[model samples]
Target: MTRPLPYFEVSQRLSIKEKVGQLFMPAAFINDSEEEVLRLEKLISEHHIGSICFFHSRASAATNFEGKKEVIHNKNSFGRLKELIKRYRAAAKYPLLIAIDAEWGLAMRIENTPQYPYAITLGAMQNQAELVFEVGKQIGLDCRKAGIHWNLSPVVDINLNPENPVIGYRSFGDDKKQVIEYARAYIEGMYSMDVLNSIKHFPGHGDTAVDSHLGLPTIEKSEPELLQNELYPFTELMKKNIDSVMVGHLAVPALSHGKAESASVSKAIITDFLREKLGWSGLIISDALNMHAVSKKFDRKGTVECAAFEAGNDVLCFADHVEEGIRNILEKGKTAQIEKSFERLWKLKERALSSELVDGHLQQDEELMQNLAKESLSLLKGTFSELEEFRNNGFEYLQIGKQNGLFSELLSNRTNNGPNTLLGIFPKQVKPKDNFGLTDTELQLIGQTLKEKNTVLYLFGNPFVLNLIDWQQAKTVVVAYQDFRSFQENAANHFMGKIEAKGKLPVTLKS
Candidate 1:
C-alpha cells in the first residue's frame, strides 16, 4: 500500500479543467433513474466534477414548490442512496465529498432513516447542550454509514421572525446567545465523529419574511443590529474553528453598502465582512445556486457560480450549469483564486474522507431523542397541575388536524361528552406562511370550540402558528415543538401528570 499525497500536493497537480470542476458541488438525487444517474455520472467523469449534495429526489428538492412533478416515494431510499453514492464516488476523478442537508439527520433527505429533533426543538430544551451534541453525533454517524462526507447543517440562523417561511422551524430560536450555544454543541458533536459540518445561512437568514427559494428576501436591519443579533452566532461559531460557513442568498443592504446583490454574491458581504472583518479563513460554501433569490438574475448561466466564487465562496453548491460555470471562471482569468479555493476544498475533503464510517447507535439514539422530546416540551400558557387536573377530571379530548395515533391510543380512556375539552391541534404545515397551512374551516372550528367550551389546547408544531388564531380563550396551552411520536407520547404523559413539563419557550410569542 502506498501513502497518498497531501491535499496541498494533490491540489497543486490538478489540471485547469479539474481545478474548475473542483469548485462545483452539484445536486445528486437518490431516486434518479439510470438515465438521470448516467447524466450526472457523465458530468462527474467528463467535467471533472468534485462533489455532490444529495437530495431525496427531484420533486423533494427545494425548487419543487410549485408541484411541477409528482413525488414518488421509494421505500428503499436508504439502500438506493448507498448505491448512488458508491457509483458517484467511483465516477469521480478524485475522492468526492458527499454532502446533504442532514440538519436533523439522514431523515432530512432520506425516507427510511433515523431522525433527530429540529433545531427549534433542541433549542427549547433547558440547559441540554449535551443532548443537542449527542443528536449531532448520532446524525454524523448516520451520515458516515451512508457514505456521506459532509452534513450541510446546524443552521445557526437566529429565528427572529416568526413569519420566516424557510428558516423558522430550521433555525434554533430568536435569542442570539442561545442559538450560538446550541449550534456549538451540534458542530462539536459532528466534530467528535470527525464528520464535516457547515454552520450555515451566513450573516443570518432568520429574520426575513420571504423564502429565498421563491424570491429574494431583503433584510432592512442596520449593520450594527445585524452584528448584535443575526451575525452573533456566526461570529461566535467562527471563533471555534468551524469547518465551513454556508452563505445564503439574502439581500443585506447594510452589509452590501446599499447595493441590492445578495450576501452569497456580494463581495462586500462575503469578502469584505466575513473574510476580512471577521478574519475567517475556513472554507466558504454557497447555498444552493439554483435558488430563485440568486439564480433568477443569473438565469443559471454559470454567472451565479462565477459571482459566488468572486464573492468568496469556495464551493458552489447545487450549481445547475457545471460546464458553463467552469468556462466562466476560466474566462475571467481567476486561476489563482480558483487554486486557493481548490486547495481549501481539498483540505476539507481530506478531513471528510479520512473519517471511519460509524453505525449501530439506533437504540441509544432513540433514548436520547426521547429524552430531548420530554425535555423540550414547554408549558407556555397553563400550569402543569391544571393540565393534569383537566385530564383527571374526564375531559373530552378532540384533535383539530392530523391525528397522532400514539397520543390517541394513550388517551383512549378519555370521554367525549365531558364539559372541558382537550383540543390537540396538529398544524397542517410547519412554516408560518398561509397561516401555518391552517384552513379557514380549521380556524373557524378552533375559534368556535374555544368560545363554546373550556378547552385545553396542546399545539404540536411550530409555536408561531399560535399567533395566527385566537388561542387566548383556551383554558390552558402546552407547546410540544414537534409532532414526532416521542413528542406525542411525552405530551400525553404530561397531560396525565406522568412527567413534568420543564421547557421554556425558546422564542417569545406575541400576546
Candidate 2:
C-alpha cells in the first residue's frame, strides 16, 4: 500500500503551479448570473486559489434601505457559498479558506444585511471591550452563515494623521494604547466565533495623507518613531496571538533601502521588523497587489509578486493577473520561495478550520441590527437644545450630503413635508469631478438655500467634505460623519432636543 505523503514533505514538493496558486486570493463577483458563478468555480478549481473576497456589488440579494426587494436571502447565500466551496474542494489539492472584509459586519460589505456604524464611530466609544466583542460576534455570525472563515478587519492602524484619506473612519484612533485595547477585543471576539481576523497595514498606514489605492505613500519616520507609535498596536496584539497582519504598500525611506518601494514588498519592514523583531508567528498577507500603489509602479517590471513573497507575505491578494504573475515567478526560478509561502498559507487554513468553536445564542437576528445601528451611531459634538431650536425656527430649506436613503426623506419630512429645498453635495472620488464636485445647478441651489433659510441645518455626511462646504454662512452645521438614515435621523433629532448629541468628533473637521 502506498503511504500518504508527510504534510511538510508534500508541501515542499508542490509544483510551481500549485505553489503559486497558494499565494493568490482573488475577488469573486457574485451576481445573479450563472455565468459569473461558473467563472468563479473555474478559477477556484483550476488555479486552486486559497481564498475569495466578496464586495457589495457582487451580492445577489441586496436592496435599497427602504426598498422591499431582497437582492439575496440568507439561506440562498449560504447554500450557494457551500456549493462553491464543494466545487473548489473537489478540484483543489487542499481545502480553500473563504473570507470577506466585513470590518463592521457583513452589512459593511453586503447589502440586504444589517449595516453597523463605521469603525471610527466605535473608536469614539468609551466601552471598547463591549463594542469590540459585539462587532466580532456580529461579524462572526454573518460570516459563518455565508461559509466565510476570515474577516479582513478591525483596522488596527493608529489614525494619527487626521487628513489620512483611506484609513480615516476605518482605524480605531490615533492613540496607540487605545488602538491596542480595542483591537484586542475585536480579535478576541472574532476568534471566539472561529473567524480568523487580519490586523492590517503593518507598521501603520495611519500617518499618510495619500490613499494607497491611488498611489504609493512614503513615511519618513525612523524605526524608533514607528515603534513608539505605529508598531505599538501590532506588538501588543501579537502578544495576544492575532491570526494575521496585512502589509500595506507604504514607502518609508528611513526604514527601507529605496524610496518608492512600499512595506508590502519591503524585506526590512515585513521580514525584519514584523517577523523577526516583533516575532509575529501569524500569517502575513499583502494588501491588494492590484492596488495602484504597487501595480502602477511595479506591474510592468514583474517585480511585485516576487518582492511580496521575499518580503515574507504568505498570501498575495487581489493580483490582477494571478496566473501570469505566477508564471513569471516560476520562470524566474523562485519555486522554492513559493513552496515556503505555501506552507505558511496551508498552516493558516488548518488553524482557521481548527478554530471552529460556536455560540448558539450568537446567531444573526433582525432585532440585533437595530441595536447595532443604535449603538454604533456617534453623537459627535452638539446639544439637545439645538433640536428645539431647529423645530422652533422651522427652516424652509435644508442642505444634505448627496446620498440616496431614508435620512434624506426624514429631513425632507421634518423640514418642509416633502422634497423641500434640499441641496446635495457629492463625495470625493479618484477623479476630481467624479467626487465632491457639484454641478452648476447644484451649486446655485445650495447658494439659494443658504440665502433663503433663516435656520440652515446642514447635514454633513462625510467629514472630509466639510472644507468644501460654505459653513461660514450656515445657521447650524451638524456633522453626521456618515449618511446612514439612523445617523441622519439621530442628528436631526438631537438638533430638535429629541435626543442629546453625546458623540465627540472621531476625526477633526476643518471648516
Candidate 3:
C-alpha cells in the first residue's frame, strides 16, 4: 500500500478548492449525453466534485419515469459502466470515490451482473450466516471489478412496517436481533473483501409509509422508542470500525426537537446525537440531496447544500448544483467543520483505494444465491410428493402479475405454452390506484385455472399480496417473498421437489 500524508499534515497542505471538493459526492448515471458528459467533466475539473454515487437509468427495477425518458436504455450496461467509470476517474482531480447502491449486488442497478437474494431472503435462512458473509464478499469483489470504491448498503433498518414504501424486502426483517447479526456478518464479509460498506438511513427509514424520494415522511417515535427498536442495529454496528453512516431523510421530530426537515441535515441529530452521544468518528454522509424530502422544503437549491454542510455531514450526496453548493459551503463560513470533513474523507479514500482491484475474477455466485433462495422458499400449502409428481408429469404454467417482465421472465424455464392451459399467479400492488406496479388480476386468472386443471399457485411478492384473497381454495400454494427472476427460478425448483422447501415465513402471513 502507498503511504500518504498524515491527516493533520494533509489538512494543512490542502487548498480551499481541494477541501471543498472533498465534501461533495453527487450522483452519476450509467450512460450519458455529450452535454451531460461535459457537465460532469466541468464539475470534476473546475468545481472539484469529490465522489459520484451511481444509479441506473436503464436497469431500473421500478418503471417510475415515462414519456421520452422511458424509452432510453443504455446498451451493454456492465461493459458501458466499466468504460464510463474509467473516463470519470481520469476527469477527477483527486481519486474520486465511485459508489453504488448495490444492495443485492450490482444487479440492483446494472442489468447483467451477479445477483444475490434480497436481505429478507437471506435473513430467512437458518444457520446460514456464512452464506450471507459470502454474499457481501462477492458484492465487494464486484465493486472492485467495476472500479467502485464504496457499496452504499447493508441496510440495517429493522422492518417495523410491512407498508413501508421503499424498505420492505430491502431490509432484513422486523426482528431486531436477526437484523443485527446478519448486518454484522455482511459488514465483516465486505470488509474482508476490502470494499467499504455504509449502514444506511440512520435512526431508521424502515417504519415509514411514505417514500423519501417522493416526499418527507415523519417517524413519530420518541427518542427512547428509537433507541430500543430502530436505533439498535446502528448502535451495535457503530461499536465496530464502521466506514460510514448515511443519515435518513426523515422528519425525526423527537430527535431534532421538532425540526421540519429530515435528520440528514439536522445539526442536533448529526453532531450532538450521532457524533457526540454515540461517539462516531467515521464519515457522515447525507442521503441523496435531490430527494424530495430535503429538496421540497428548501426554496433555493444552494440552501439545502449549505445546511447539509453546516449540519456536520462530511459528504453531501446527490447534490443537484455542485458549483452553487460549493459556493454556499464557502459562504456559510464553517472553516473548521470543512477541514474536519476533508480529513475524514481522505482517510476513507485511502482505505478504499489501497485495496487491489480484481479484474474479472468475481462472477455472480448463482449457486449460492439459489441455495439461499431454496432455503428461503416456504411451502405454504403443498406436499413434496405432489411437487415431484407435477415436475415429472409436467404441469402447464399460467402467469399472473406484471405481463412483459415479472411473470414472463420467471416461468421461462417452465412449459407455459403446454396444452391444458395452466394457471400462472402474479401480485397486484396492495393499493390498486398506486402509480407504476404489477396488476393483481393474474391471481384471479390463476384461480380460474385452478377451478379446472390440476394447478400449483406460486406467489412471488409481498405476503400482503394475499392480504384479503382466499388462496386456501387452491390446493398447492407457495409464497416466495419477492418476484425477481432468481426467486421465480428457485420457486420452480422447489415446486419440482428438486429443491426441498427449508424456508419458514420471515413475516407472518395472516391469510
- TM-scores for all candidates: the values are 0.97, 0.80, 0.88
TM-score of decoy 3: 0.88
Compose the digit string of candidate 3's lDDT tens values, residues 1-511: 2334566777777688678877888777786666777778788877777788887863231323322445356558888788878888788766778899998899878777777777877877767778889888888889888888899989999887756777877888888888988898998888988888899989799888888777788988899999999999999999995899999898888989887768988998999899999899999999888877788778886888888888889999888878888888888747888888888898988788876777884476768766677777777776988666665665566666655354445445766444333344555542322421444454455556766667677767665555445667666777776666667777766665667778765655453
lDDT of each: 0.85, 0.65, 0.77
What lDDT, from 0 to 1, does candidate 3 have? 0.77
Q: Please say which candidate is ahead in TM-score: 1 or 2.
A: 1
Q: So what's the TM-score on candidate 2?
A: 0.80
Model 2 lDDT per residue over 245-344, tens place: 9998799876675555888988887888778877887789998886777777674644677667777788877665766666667776455667777777
Q: Name the candidate, 2 or 3, with the larger lDDT value.
A: 3
Model 1 spans with C-alpha error above 4 angstroms = 1-4, 359-364
Q: After superposition, how far is residue 379 of candidate 1 from its true place, in Å?
A: 0.3
Worst 10 residues of 2 by lDDT: 57-66
